[model samples]
Target chain A: MISQFIFIIILGAAVYLFGKNVAKVRRNILLGKDTDRSDNPAERWKLMAKVALGQSKMVKRPTAAVLHLFVYVGFVIINLEVLEIMIDGIFGSHRVFAGPLGGLYGLLIGSFEVLAFLVLASCVIFLVRRNVVKLKRFTGTEMTAWPKSDANYILITEILLMAAFLTMNAADYKLQALHVGHYVTAGSFPVSALIAPLLPAGAGALEAIERGCWWFHIIGILAFLNYLPYSKHFHILLAFPNVYYSNLNAKGKFSNMASVTNEVKAMLDPSFVPETTEVSRFGVKDVTDLTWKNLMEAYTCTECGRCTSVCPANITGKLLSPRKIMMDTRDRLVELGNNIDKHGKDHTDDKSLLDNYITREELWACTTCNACVEACPVNINPLEIITEMRRYVVMEESQAPASLNNMFGNMENNGAPWKYSQADRFNWAEKG
Target chain B: MELNIPTMAQMVAEGKTPEILFWVGCAGSFDERAQKITRDICKILQHVGISYAVLGTEESCTGDPAKRAGNEFLFQMQAMANIELLNAYEVKKIVTGCPHCFNTIANEYPGLGGTYEVIHHTQLIQGLINDGKLKAEGGESFKGRRITFHDPCYLGRGNGVYEAPRAALEVLDTELVEMKRCKTNGLCCGAGGAQMFKEPEKGNKDINDERMVDVIEAKADVIASGCPFCMTMLSDGVKHLNKEQDIKVLDIAEITVRANGL
Candidate 1:
């Protein structure tokens, strides 16, 4: 009863912490600016199919893909076991895979146990890939975060998971040895048989150890769950939906410019554009300038830096790095969240929040190539955010490259990009 | 009644209910060779009993170049005016010899509610050939003429009109050698997206020059194009390399006209 009470308290605390963290993360994500204006339904559907179900981006690197897939599948399957564990801890009877369904449950648990092992093995390979193999492309990337600590966490989590699986196996083995009529133990006796030899000769000691390990496993899982919202592992939950809603259309297609008259009227009259301000513009300069979806994308990023690898500008030694853009946004959101948490809405009064995070040059360096969006495993659209900033710079602040300004002038005056007479339009053709 | 040279207004003035509206875009109207070939196409249409009205000077820029330059407002203004003009005449379909005009009219104009069935002259010529209305003379004097088609981005990737131009070239009895990058992946002639209007950003080699090298590598005697802009650029590149003496640049329409012994 005492153990059950302790487990309940821990579980409750974990659920509360996880829920709070998720809400905070969600609020931050919602606060970023939106810039994507794609209307291509076919592209959206293809993206949804490929990224969501096909796991196309993740599979581009095979080893990590396989490992991640096992972990993903195990995490999903283990949810059922979690519910069963909670029920068993509370009620004394494990009814999840009991009776007629016992065979199927035993098979599922056996398969999941094997998958968990594979997943753990894959995590080790991932560590090697990140550290020892140290692919040159990953050198300056933001995805290579605190490698040693992350590896340690991953290793501990895997061990804890395995311990949980083994504890359950040990209990089933003992029950079978004692001739106790447990549903799962009947079909799982062979697995139990192998583990039984490793157990101490004394049944009482083994039982106590089993009880302790089981609690440790459960506690470890709850702790991991609580840590999920604060760690890079947050993508384990966020990437699914982000992939589902990814943009798949042709690159560099900006959303249709809103009708200028509508915009003006909206700004002048509150009824037109309900969300308008005297100093407000249609681009993101800071966290507040971002839309909800943009923020969501920042939060959902797995920091794999696949986006940085494919960025043409980054490849050519340009200032633009898509991974850094996401990281900056995420870090800024956390900073803002911390501020808001401390000072409430008065956090907006804090001037330092806007000073040093993201720069205008960093925003302008993008070529608006959809490479970042295409390369991102979680389907974050960095180009959309970049273009949104461009729109703001161009429309609101009247800021643009001088060449663009010259082109604009030539376009207005000559109906072309040159100051030469319209007669020059056919000069080359006349020569031909 | 004397026929005033068929300006766009004059064509529109003849009657609202013409059989076809020949959209002699700015390039076709202004370029001497393009104007000559367009006149030849008009004669061919007349011979085939296809009555058409030409929208002459009233045909402004299709705003493709402007839009590509990131001047969205100018594009919208031009598009809105063009839509209004076309709507005024109740013009159902438009035919143009210019691929840029065709792409702009067919693809970009719809964004401004200016939807119309637009086709390239090559498509119409192919249709004429398929219907047995157009026939090419066999074994015409030109020999040792290995020609390659330069697939303009607006025609090839922009609208997927690859086969029609190739069909026109095939009918001309020229050996059609393809460059390395043809069809959808075809290199730009450095004239697209208003690069014709603005100086191209400094790169190691001009895009058209890079493309012409492929043409030179193919060892083709002539570079034929469906778009006038491509013809001009490729010709310039060929000339800059002093390959002008060995090579010739001709529009597919001009080649077809030549095949018909015009």
Candidate 2:
């Protein structure tokens, strides 16, 4: 009874802490400016189902997709068993659902053991890929220190958790064979049954191992849950909502700034007075200038360098890595969120995302090719952020490059990007 | 070799509206090399007897460059002016040589109260071929040569029109080779997002040079392109490698024109 009480307290505290972190993430995302992503509910649901739930986009790279699928499907399925653990801990019942579920419980546990084994093997392979083989996509300039270790750390934690789960099942199965008190002949552990012979024969020893493994497994999962908010593994949660709200329009369309449109309307049609909102500096200067969807995408980034690997600028050795753009956004958001927490919302950092984190050269080098958008397993649009920052640089500061300034001037004065007269537009036809 | 390209103004004056308004983008109108592609598209349209008219002098830049360069003021001004003129014409179907113009007018313009069935020149040619209007058999045989098509970022990945341009190329007798990074995985020609206007920011290799490697690796005599900006970038890449005499960078329309005996 005392152990059960202690378990309840630990579980409650973990759940509370996990909830707090998630709430903090929600607050940080809301700190971004609002843009309506609520339109097209039907399409959004379909996309979410396909991309996030179905893992449709993931299969473009078959090898990683298969490995990730094993881990993903396994982790999700095993959490059902976690749900049962929560119930057992709260109610102080041994395999509480066993009597009602009957043979179905056995079937479920057998399958879970198989999934746990797969999860363990997959994580070991993943650790090898990241540390030993070192895939080029994972070893980019942005995958420094914490980012690199964050991936490995989660994989290791998962391996440890799965090991404990299998070991616990094995010990419990042996105890059931010994006919120990409260150790019912329940769950059919096909994989763990192999290890039953390797365990201690004595009921007392088996019970000690079973209890130790159960506590370790549950605690490890709770700790992993809390750690997700601080790691790239947060994508496991954010990818669903991130993909649902991703841009559904044609990839070519960069949205026209409505404020700019209103200004243009007044100049073009004097009779039309457009409604205007109080403006901040044009485009994205900091994390707050970004749309909430953009902020969510920042958090949703898996730090998979699929985008950077395919980037024209990055491929040719330019500084712009799309993955880095996402990382920087998240890093800045975390910093700003912490600042607001400590010093209130009115705090000033005097440092912005624009010159401080992402450089002008990095911004200028992007081709806006949408390679990054397509490459993301989850639909994260790094191009939008790049264009928005470019907007602030051009409109707010008039800091466009000399050539782009020339191109803009020519377009305004001559109706072409060059100094050619509009009269010359028909010159191509005059040839015949 | 006379072509039957009329301005919307002239066609309207004669009480005969064209089936499609051909938006002769700034590149097609003024870029010296791109002008040849403009002529070839006109020849194909004439050969196929599709009633298409140019926007002519009234047409302005689509402000893709301006918008991409982050000058939203200039971009909106251009977009609004263009949308007004396009609306005035009551254009139902439109086609353009450049993907940038097609994307902007088709996708972006509708939000500003200007929407039409905007199709790229490659898609236009692909349609004509599929409809049995343009027979690309033996006018200028490319049977002995291998041709690789460079996917313009805006056209292929941007608008998801990868297959149309390839369809036009497939009709030709030439070997249609694909680069490793083709279709949705296609690399940029280093000129998108208004990058064409400015010097590239301190990269080890120019994007065009990297794209040219794909063309070279595909072992093609010709690199077929649709976007004028791509034509310029890829052609400059050929010049960079001094491979101009060996490899020709022809627009898909130009290729279609050659194949149809126009």
Candidate 3:
């Protein structure tokens, strides 16, 4: 009965995870219609190699970088233990590996235990750095929407993960005391020895307790896995690709003006251009207009606020905050996603998501200086989105700063931005 | 007939295989003091055995100001016409006295299929000095004169030609004091990007005014620059700040011409 329950639970969890992940991938593909320069396969691969495997972005801050590296590696390697836990739950044996393999498994578990302890220690330091140390650096100065819930979630998740680890050790001790079937518990023997003395003196009750603890450990891991897609921890999956595919050039150099022109023309006249109108306008006005990569960026934002700390515009008291823009776009996107899921695409009467969210003043205040992009640890190019929106406002709606409009008109008439006669163009020269 | 003010075609028809094309930009051709310096550069080049062709009244604005103003179409048309005119003369290279025109032709013209080797007159003068083609008399060294170089936005940040202008100043052996923000991180002269053509938005301090104080702080005898736009703005800033008598604005070309005793 226990084996059947474990098997059904594992199967259900796997299916749910796979289905949700697929839906996420599909939604992203559908949303990321505005990403420029997807033609170069070699460039994409090179970026992936450097960003994903190398952990390049995290290294911007040394202390945080070191802490993240261990957590990242620990999170990845410990999946094997998760798998082992699920298998043991079905098989009625605490140890899955036998003989030489069993010895290796014990070693791996010991190593994982040490890494877990390190990750916990680093996470504590990170918390202190963010909270007690009161370092302005850790504050997400850019994103005002960074919920207080995020810190709580991180703290609780760490504690829960540690709980899972301890419970597994307790189960291991009970199994050893019961004289379980032979499986080399080599490296784990020390853990079992320490745990054995702590187990209840009544052997009969210990077996039942061991089974219950095993179930708790498995459920704890599964619950954490399911919670990942909904939390800021979603960055663990998204940041890898986000960093890899990030623009390799300087901030302002990411997209050319010529490319933007081509896109605008294509949107206006599809028959002449033959390129399908994937999304209207240049900038991301709503969540659906954002490219999947941008949506991924929204999900991946750890709310670390590193981008805001270095923004020249923010420091100078400009209304633009790169982090806030990203979070606002993301919040609207999530709301839009929920609406779409609930009501389908036919629900067009719903109010425009962008109007209620980002203000016109916030849009105009940005100087397109790539400082925010440069400071971002996760490779979110907020300036690109900001500029694209500006382009749309200027070209499509013909709405821009009144002074800029007059300057553009003057440029059209006199070939100079000043409304002087063409004859007087060289007046400055004659005076010299 | 369309008024042909000694176009490159006419110059070529006269059997002139000019050693250089002196691109007197729109500002230099019209502004009085700027025109004098342009004429000075022409006379200097002529004396140095370098025959140069002038575009005269045929020259027009480089359309940089238009492009920066967001009139992309007008800028494109201007670029296309300039390219055709330059290519008509089989112009292999150009030397401009204007930094804006120099930068536009050197950096932006290639995008419009007009690729020619372009150099600022200051850079050419520096090269000439280096090659022993131009010699300067070291009579009384201007060493004690604290001179600061104001980096033009177009020539410095837009094109990364900071060192060449500084190099020209270094050859003169003056006490070159630098502002806190110089070279790539240099602040603008409140000109360039067509900002000169428009009234500046109300702000606590003018960018150029803020820049002039750096020169004042250095107690510099001169505020030198390679770009004519910077020269004009910095000169105006010095005067506006009532330091015109104490601090003078001189183009690197003007300074170079003086150093050569021309």
Candidate 4:
């Protein structure tokens, strides 16, 4: 009875704290400007199912895709066992469904046991891939320190959690054979059956290991739930909505600014009057200028450098890296979020996403190729942020590169990017 | 055969609305090298006996350069003026020699109250081939020569028109080699996003030169391009590497014209 009371309190506190952290992230994402993404209900759902749920994009890299499937499928299905564990925790019963479920319970637990074992193998392989093999995409300059360690920590945590789960099952299987009190012969343990012989024959020792592992497994999951918002592993939750809200239009379409449209029309025509609105900053200098979807993208980045690896600028040794842009945006957003949390919403910061995190050179190097957009397994659009920052650099400050200024002048005065008379536009049609 | 290219204004004055209004972009109209491709496109239309007219003086920049450089104000201004002119002509169908113009005017202009059936020149040529209006009869044989199609970023990745350019090449009697980075995975030619107007940022190598590595690896005897910007970049790359004699960077329209003996 006392143990059940403690279990409820721990579960309650964990859920409350996790909910609070996720809510804070939601608030931070909503701090940005609003743009409607809720229009295409049917398409968004289909895309979400394919890209996020089906892991369709991940299959582009076959090795990673297959490995990721094992872990993802295993983790989600194994958590079903947690439901049984929770009932046992709350009701102070041993395998409460054992009598009612009969044979099906054994099959369900058998599948989970096999899945748990696969999850363990996949995690170990991933750890080696990260630490030993050191894939080029994982070793970008921005992936230094915390980013690298965070990946390792998640993998290690998952491995430990799976280990505890399997150990708990193995001990329980051993105890069931001995016909110990309340140690129900319920689950078919294909994986744990092997480990059952390794466990001590003494029923008391086995009970202690089983009970200890059971407690450790649930606590580990609760802790992992909290750890998500702090790490790049947050992608597990955010990937679904992010893929749904991804730009569905042609890759060529950079959305037109309505404010710019109003201002430009008023300038072009003598009779035209601009719609009156508060003077808006031209482009994204900070997180606040970005669309909420862009902010959501920042938080959703998994820091996989498939984008950087394929980027034309980055490929040719340019400072620009799409993955770094996402990381910097998220870092800046978190910094701003913390500032608002401590010093209230009105508090200001000298540091911005530009200059402080992403540099002028880095911003200029991008070719705006959609390789990054296409390469992202999560369907994150880093090009949108890069262009928005480029807008801030050009429109807000009037600090465009001198050559681009000449090009802009040509477009404005001569109706072309180069200095050529419009009269000669038809010159190509004339007989030489 | 004499090329019959009428201005939309001239066509309108004659109470004639042609089939497709040709959007001869800034590069096609002005750039000396690109002008050749422009003429060949007009030649292809005339050969196919399709009723088409040029925007001529009525045409201006699509503002792709300004828009990409983050000057949306200039972009919309150019776009609005062009849209007003295009709408005045009641242009129903449109074609462009430049992918930049095709992308901006087709994709970006529609939101600003201008929409038309826009097709890239390669797509137009592909349609002509598919309809049996064009053929490779009595044309230069590319037999035993390797030709690679450098998928222009705007045309392929931007608009998803990968097969059309390749289809134009299919009528030719040659080996079509794909670069290591081709189609959606294709690398940029260091000329996108207003990069054509300015010097590249400090890097180990120029992006075009980097793209040339793919060209060299493909062992291409000729580089067929669909975009004018790509033609300039790929041609310059050949020249830079002193492979000018080795590789001929011809636009798809030029190759089509040469292939069909038009």
Query: Which candidate gets the maximum lDDT versus the true structure?
Result: 2
TM-score of chain A of 1: 0.83
Q: How well does candidate 2 match the true structure in TM-score terms?
A: 0.98
Work out the TM-score per prediction. 0.69, 0.98, 0.70, 0.98
**DockQ of all candidate complexes:** 0.12, 0.85, 0.16, 0.81
Task: Write one digit per residue (lDDT tens) for candidate 1, span A247-286.
Answer: 4433323444555434534544567653433436544567
Q: What are the clashing pairs of model 2?
A: none
lDDT of 3 at A387: 59
Better of 2 and 3 by DockQ: 2
Off by over 4 Å in 3: A1-4, A7-11, A34-36, A89-107, A137-146, A166-184, A188-218, A248-284, A287-293, A349-354, A419-432, B1-262
In the predicted model 4, the residue pairs found to clash are none
Residue B122 in candidate 2, Cα distance off native in Å: 1.2
Best by DockQ: 2
Docking class of 3: incorrect
Model 2, residue A212: C-alpha shift (Å): 0.8
